[model samples]
Target: MAFAAACAAVLAAGTAPASAQAEPALTYIWPVHGTIVDHFRPPAHEYGPGNRGLEFATQPGSSFWAAARGVVSFAGPVGGRLHVTVSHPDGLRVSYSGVAGIGVKRGERVHQGQLLGTTADRLHVGVRRGEVYLDPVLIFDGDASTGVRPPLSRPRLVPASTSVYRLQLRWLHSGAGIAVL
Candidate 1:
């Protein structure tokens, strides 16, 4: 294949092996340009009723795009609303409800801002990591004027102290030990 040949040529020139490809980023944007009518409400209990996603007030038949790049997990009518669930590579699933029509099918990969469906009376956006429903506003900057697209911020990592070092030791049968840093 052309990719294999390219790697071979790079290696033959006394260069290092190609670096591992990175996973696609979790970029999210406003799926539709509308006023935020209802914000996400946390549930009182595990089975208590609560708003899991944000609801936008958009006109009927307005096109709604995907908030992030992911694979379509579900696309169909549920509870009298056309719902579409996209599973991101990071194990987070975003669900859109109150859509009129779905442009993407189940198992289809969608890019950020890709058209997913037509908005109905109300567009609901829900996010869940496993069974926990998260606040959708946490991903947005809260400053999207006229729905201007802005790349979502990546998750931050906990800072580590420079003087702190944790080591793992594994003993081998050859009377040697390996120290993993």
Candidate 2:
């Protein structure tokens, strides 16, 4: 169906906002004043073991800042490590792990530079478009982790092999395809 084809296109192009013309502009702060120590590495499949976010080497207890304006979907411990997940506008969500000294509450909206929490040896930051994990570094101007000043390029998405894509193709062939929006 035509609807299914559109859904497939959207998935192939990554989870950009509905209003996205080129790549979606990620207007966000660095969230913490730390050196980039790690980067997002996509796995062969969803739920597989992989580092789906970036890690920043900060002090023992550096406070983390909100990357953009959005509501806090979750802020608590995951596997005993403190974490925060913020649902930003346009179905985008940013998450911070290894946080401490929680200062924000769940369901509370935050701004671009608002304080979120403190960090440990390294802060893990992940960006998600809907349920798909994205490279947190993709939104930044350059790879600060390496201390390089290279020019930034257009945002490119990390391809994911989730069930959604498999189902999309199945639906399109079975005349049951549907758009998520």
Candidate 3:
């Protein structure tokens, strides 16, 4: 009976709280230090008009860095605006638009805090997982002293699916030339 009780105790010890066994949280930083001119506003529908990212008002020539390590999935002009996108290992894709210059190229691996490029008057940073766009403010770590506040809620992660393939095709048709990383 004592041996059986010991076995049960061991089994119970293995079942820890979910938080104790959870995966390490991904750490992200701001791409650029500036005032948030525009906040993320999810569209009513996928194709509806809305601000899908955060817009920072910084000096026109100020340089922006990669928020996290990832591969340069797309770097070029999109709808007349210069953009650079990094596909993070965590399955998150971060796109920096309104760049005045391009420092990285497609398929190039970039480290966190690496120089991405310079922005024009403002920089637009977007984050996505699969087909669902996430709020950049939630993913990034912001300090109140810098005028950036911590995220009020957790981000919802959607699994990657065929929608990702459709997104690539859409970009291709739009002449963005964004290939899978």
Winning model by lDDT: 3
**Number of the top-ranking candidate, with TM-score as the measure:** 1
Predict model 1's lDDT versus the native: 0.76
Give the per-residue lDDT digits (tens) of candidate 3, residues 1-181.
Answer: 9999999999999899887786655557778867888999999998999999999998998889888888999999989999999998788899999899999999999877788899999999998989888888877775322546576454523233477778868878775576644
TM-score of each: 0.67, 0.63, 0.65
- Residue 22 lDDT (model 1): 63
Model 2 Cα lDDT, one tens digit per residue, 1-181: 9999999998978876766656455466567777777777888898688888888898988778887788999999889888899997757788998886789999998877787888888899998876787777655544333544334333423232467587667777775466432
Off by over 4 Å in 2: 1-26, 141-181
Q: Which ten residues in a row have the lowest lDDT in candidate 1?
A: 165-174
| lDDT for each residue of candidate 1 in 10-70, tens digit (9 for 90 to 100) | 8888754457456655656667777788988888998888898899999999888877788
106 Cα displacement, candidate 1 (Å): 0.5
Candidate 2 C-alpha RMSD relative to the actual structure: 20.2
Taken over the whole model, the C-alpha lDDT of each candidate is 0.76, 0.76, 0.83
